[model samples]
Target chain A: MTLALRVEHLRKSYGAVAALDDVSFEVERGEVFALLGPNGAGKTTSIEILEGFIARDAGSVEVLGIDPGDRQHLRGLRDRIGVVLQELAVESFFTVRQVLERNAGFYPHPRDVEEVIDMVGLSEKSDAKVKRLSGGQQRRLDIGLGIVGNPELLFLDEPTTGLDPAARRTTWDLIRHLAAEGTTVLMSSHYMNEIEALAQRVAVLSHGRVAALGATATLGGRDRSEATIRFTLPSGVAASDLPITPWRVEGDTVEVRSDDELRALHALTSWALEGHIAVTGLSVARETLEDIYLALTRGDRAEIDEEPDDTKARTP
Target chain B: MSTDVRPAPQRSRFSDLRLVAHQVKYEQLAFWLNRVGAVFTVGFSVVFLVMLGASAGSQKVQSLGDISLVSYYVPGFIAYGVMAAGFTTLSVTLVVRRETGLLKRLRLSPVPTWVLISSILISTAIITLVQALLLVVIGRYGYHVAFPSSWLALLVAVIVGILGFAAMGVAISAVVPNQESAGPVTSIVFFVLLFLAGLWFPLPPNSGLAKFSNYLPVRHLIIAMDHAFGVPRGATPWAWHDLLVVALWGAGATLVSLRRFRWAPRRV
Candidate 1:
């Protein structure tokens, strides 16, 4: 498969602190790749380096087969790439349409300004000055400017940070649509749900290093982590009556760990039937992406109480 | 999945030029929309011209044998107006843009660095010229100040003054820590230079202050403008020495700004 971006052994430092140390990852063409991390986790540094805004002290970075660090290749590479920075960058006085039209002139080939405006759901506010638009609307204008160039690879840094839930969903749809149309996207976000919904693959960073990296479902061995079965015992049923021995009891709720979920579930149902006790509020859950992420980044420091009481998942 | 993908077309120099033109156009639009800033840029010079003309209309300067004090003040205020547009306005705008992350965003765009700088310079030149024209119109109609005897010399001096001050503005912006500091810093430097260069009244010739002013670009600009206005006969319209001084300052400031200007805001 052709790769849209490749970063190997990237190293950057600010004085004595290393912002990125030996960070490496690859994004295949036409895939939505995510960089997930908490604040100061090197997400912005890595994105800025790939955007060609900052020079790395040491690394090999190639975007679409062009070295982003090479100045001579910048114009050609930038023509095919789009960046949505964290800050709102458009002039506050320019109307949405005007801003899009002005940015469109910078590219050799660009989408029509009207089309871009509509694509970002700003058609209704196209004539409104940027200063007059709401915060979310202004962000939509920022996204419009990014895509008006009809770029082959788009970099979105915290694109949905301040967006409301509905707007966030819309942005996710737009990103998926772009990927379906063969435009590769690299996005950084702290929203776990956003990453779970949009990213096919993810790299989690912590303390300036890759804490975990893999397909979304398999990241940090999330898919292999044990499933949890929680049920509220019927009235007059004691924890001793439960068939599962290794269970945590709180009030009337008992949580059972299961290596083989189906077998454990079958055993519990049979036990309940034999004892003539009804199980209520039964919930079977496996480790979610969030669980794996917290485990990987926080290691043993992650609060045990926060984890779904079933089985301890190994931290990557 | 295999699919045919077309290679992006090669960009041409014409596209760069077109982008620069658009940038200039937008810059002008934004400047116009900032009504308070636009007014202050030209208003200070207009206020000085009117006040000086009203108070010193009948007085005559010994250096300018036939020119009245009002006419003598014309070149000084014109110099002041150009400085306001080229230096104070440009520097403050740059500081604000950098602080607000606009410069960083522009840097990430496909537009070349030269294009962005050139567009700012072009827009400043245009705005300064308009201010100078407005001052001229007010001087003629309201105060009866005569038109410049040599338009070519006046044009040359104005162009040189704008280029020099614009470069100085960019240089000053490099030193300003943030937008809040931009106003005070630019004002302090401008007012000090304006006083030394004799904006309100001419400094006595051959005095200590006069000798010190000789090194300043504003002084040379005012001297060039005085000759351009034909106040004293036998004075050459082109003050080559003064023009050279202004040109040198412009070159020096351009170099300094190129080295010091930062696309990102200061971390602190």
Candidate 2:
């Protein structure tokens, strides 16, 4: 696959706090890549560096095979890259249609402003002032601006951060459409479900570094074959004194993990039959992205990654 | 088996220019709607015209005693109109855009920086021209001011005044914190320059302050317009020195803005 953007050992800091440290990732052409992180995890900073708006202290970054900061390439490069900034700042006086029409002029071949407006479902509100639009409508306008240039590479930074479920779903459809048209997208989102629904691959960033990078299903090796089964026993049954040595019992629930689903099922049924214990509310589920994210980013793990040298010295 | 590859299509120069023009057009539309632009245009014209009428009645008038009271105020008011539309408008727009992040968005766009700045400059220049023509018509019909004796000199002064003011406006925006502060800062500086440069009223045409005014930029611009009205010429050395000072200020403003201008919100 052709690579659209690549970063090597990117580093950024504000005073003593590191915003991005030794971060590296490659996004292939025409792929939807998501950067997942909690707030203040340098997702925005990394994207800003790629957009040519900020310079990195230590990194060799390339977008569309050119250094974005080089002035000679800015016009051409900007035309090819669409960026949806976290905060959309449209002049309160300008209409939605006017804003789109104006931004279209910045490219050699921008998509038709009216068509883009219609696509984003802002046709009725086209003539209304931007400040008058609803939050979701404003987000739509921001997306409209990002796509109006017909950019080959698009950057979406939390495009659905404040949207309602219905609006977010609509936005997802739009993103899917863009990706289907072969536009390369690099998105940073805090919503893991959004990433899972749209991304071909994801890089989970914690503190200043990537903790896990892979397909959404497999980040932190989350998609495991074995499933965990748990069931609650009646009051007469002793939860901890189950026949199965490997199972964990707490409150009235007996929890078991096994690779062989049928064998585990057989063993649990026979054991319950012998004990004359009634099992209720049994559930078996696979590991999810949420579970993986929790495992990777929880508590001291982030602190360790945040200050690896301090962690190493203390451990020794 | 045969292989054939087509060359890539090249973008037309017209296409590029059209894009730039479109961006600039949007910018001009936004500036027009901004309250400051409207307030300055209307307020400057109304207030100055009234001041001219009031001053003409109360103050001693010389130079072409035959010239009507309306004609006497025309050149000065037109000068005021140009400064209002161009310099004041440009500075406020810059600071507001900075505070609002519009300038940062522009920096990220595909248009050349020169084209962006030039479009604004050109728009303000056009607005000034329109206002000047309107002021001249008003002077001719309402106040019965004679047509400028040297339209060429007035034109030169207007252009120079625009360049000096617009550049200074941009430079000032770089230092101002936000749009609200920008308004007061620009107003204070503008009034100071106007009074010292003799925009409010003429100093003695040959007095020491008038001689020193010849060295002040606003003074040179006003004098240049006043000179176009067949007003007596000032000390040649001082006038040239004033022109030089204004030109230097303009150049300095542009350089300072270029060096220090930022288009992004500071990292929080």
Candidate 3:
């Protein structure tokens, strides 16, 4: 697949703090890619560099086959990409249609203003002032402005950060629709479920470094990792009498860790049936994406606690 | 197929002038639809003229060549309206937009930077024009005050004030840290300057208030307007000296804006 974006050795800093260090990633033309990180992990800095909003100290970046750092191509780069910032940037005074139409004027090849309104589900509020709409509706409008330019790639920075469950579901549906229409999306989100639900590939960033990068399901060896076997022991069973070695025992409950879960479960079940030992509450669990994300960024989170608190609430 | 990012050679896509006009249309819509702002700047001026015209308009001050109070107030408040729309309202608007992320969003769009800035400046000029016209009509017909002898001179003063004060507005916005403090900070600074410049009542020439206000751009603008209206009965309409001081201040403010302007919200 042809790549839509490429970055290598990206570095940026503010005074003494390193915002991004040697960050690199590539996004294919029509795929939805995700950047996952805790607060202050360089997600925004990276996105801004890629968008050419700011200059990077050390990096080679190409967005849509053009060097975003080159001033001559800055407008061209912006024309092909759409951005939705964390803030609801729409002015509150103008009606929904007015604001949409105003932004549509900025693009050389803009999508139909009415079509954008309908796609974002704001047709019902077309004449209402922006301030009168609910938070969810405003966010949808923000996304509409992003796509009104008919962008080939879109950037969404925490698109669903402060939304209720229903609103988040609606936003997710909207994003899915855009991706289905062949818009490559690069999104940064703290919501594990959001990443899991939307991204085909994700890069976990920690301390301005790529801690892990792979398929959403298989990152950190999650698919091939050990399975955890848990079950409650019989009341009179002695620990040593078990055929398999137990990892931990608490009261009448027992736990086992196994790399080959099929063999482990077979041996345990056969022995239990022969001896008539009733094992209750038995279940097998594997590593989840959240578990891997936490493990990768645990140190970064501890370090961020020492800084100012605005970056602290990204945990989900 | 994915390697080509340029769209249709972009040169023939659209006109930058049309983009500026479109953005200006929204900017104007935003200014007027926010009724509080429109009333605060435009409506307030109209009300001030009617109230003062009824109370002390016919009385002669004997200080400003014994011109009627209405004559003095008409020019003074015209200057006031210029500062309100170009300086106070524009500065406060910039601060709120900067702190709220609107400015940054505009920066990221495909529109050229010049277009956005030009649109805002144009919208401000339009507001100041409306207020100036309203004040002129009220003084000419409502209070029976003599109109400016050189309408062209009055236009010059108003235009200079708008451009200068608008630059000062952007300059002040760079220093005001956040939205909560924007209104109070700009208002206090604006009202203090207006008071010292004798916007409410004409200051006697060479009085202590006049001397101090002479050092400021505000009084210079009012003086320019007063001369344009032939307030002292046949004085030359172009007070080029006073207009020069106002333009210099605007130039300085433009320098400040260039050096310090920030689009993104402060991290606070």
Give the best candidate by lDDT.
3
Name the best candidate (by TM-score): 3
lDDT of 2 at B184: 86
Q: Give DockQ for candidates 1 onward, in order.
A: 0.31, 0.24, 0.41
List pairs with backbone clashes in candidate 2: B71-B145
Candidate 1, residue A256: CA error in Å?
4.0
Residue B105 of model 2, lDDT score:
69
For residue B112, model 1's alpha carbon misses the true position, in angstroms, by 1.3
For the second chain, the TM-scores of the candidates in order are 0.93, 0.83, 0.95
Count of clashing residue pairs in every prediction: 0, 1, 0
- Model 2 Cα lDDT, one tens digit per residue, A72-184: 67566887888887766567788999888888867656899999999899989999999899888888888888889888889998999879999999899889988987888
lDDT of 3 by residue, B29-59 (tens): 9899988778878888889988999999469
lDDT (Cα atoms) of all candidates against the true structure: 0.83, 0.74, 0.86
Residue A215 of model 3, lDDT score: 89
